[model samples]
Target: MQMLQLSAEAYWGVIAHAQAAVPLEACGLLAAVQGKDLVSEFFPMRNAAESAQLYRLDDAEYLQVEQIADARKLRLVAVMHSHTHTTAYPSPTDVRDASAFDPFGALLYVIVSLKHVDPVLRCYRIVGGQISEVSVEVQW
Candidate 1:
């Protein structure tokens, strides 16, 4: 099984962004030291889709974030987004989008679900159209 380690700050940053974007999906990028699985930074990004059920990282924003990560010597670990009315599972659209965007299956996809009273965060790896859950470890 795969695992993603996140710093406490990064964990809360994701939740805060998700809640703040309520009604519309929020998206962001996760970064960590090169070749490591522990995430040390979260880059909140504008959702180009701007829809409650869909999300797209703006092209310019994506490039900017990539540059920042490169300068910091960090790897782009994953792409995160929120689901306002669903569980913390990848939707069909998510699967399709992942395949289209990440053909090499390099980045993990993290989903934050706000359907219930409590928020749920789940990580996944979508490769070759197959979706598999990845465990997340929140470090203090």
Candidate 2:
């Protein structure tokens, strides 16, 4: 199984952002130095869709964040979003939207489900409309 590494701070930051979004879905990017699966930074973003069941990264913020990551020598390793009332698994909409990503880039898709009392985070690789789960390692 493929694995993605994240510092405890980065991992918690994602969960916190999800909680903070409350009734709306939260979205963000996880960055890493080029060529590494270990995430080094987290960029929480405003949800353009502003819906409890969906999320869309603000286009302007996406571009700005991309530029910022480029300047910092970081590559966005994953796109993350919160599912305000569902499972951590990707939905059909997610698979369809993931087609917008480069098939060869190996980018990760992370979903944080807020259906239960505890937050549930799951990582996935969506390529050619196929969904495969990836393991997440929260390292201290």
Please tell me which predicted candidate would have the highest lDDT against the true structure. 1
Q: lDDT tens string, model 1, 1-140?
A: 27999999999999999999989999999999987778999999999999999999999999999999999999999999999999999999999999999988899999999999899999999998999899999999
Q: Whose TM-score is greatest here?
A: 1
After superposition, candidate 2 runs with Cα above 4 Å error: 103-105
Off by over 4 Å in 1: none
lDDT of 2 by residue, 1-140 (tens): 28989988899999999999999989999999887768979999999998987788899999999999999999988999999888999999888778775566368998999999999999999988898899999998
Q: Could you tell me which residue pairs clash in candidate 2?
A: none
> RMSDs, each prediction?
1.0, 1.4
TM-score of 2: 0.94
Worst 10 residues of 2 by lDDT: 97-106
Q: Which residue pairs does candidate 1 place in steric collision?
A: none
Please state the error at residue 108 of candidate 1 in Å.
Answer: 0.2
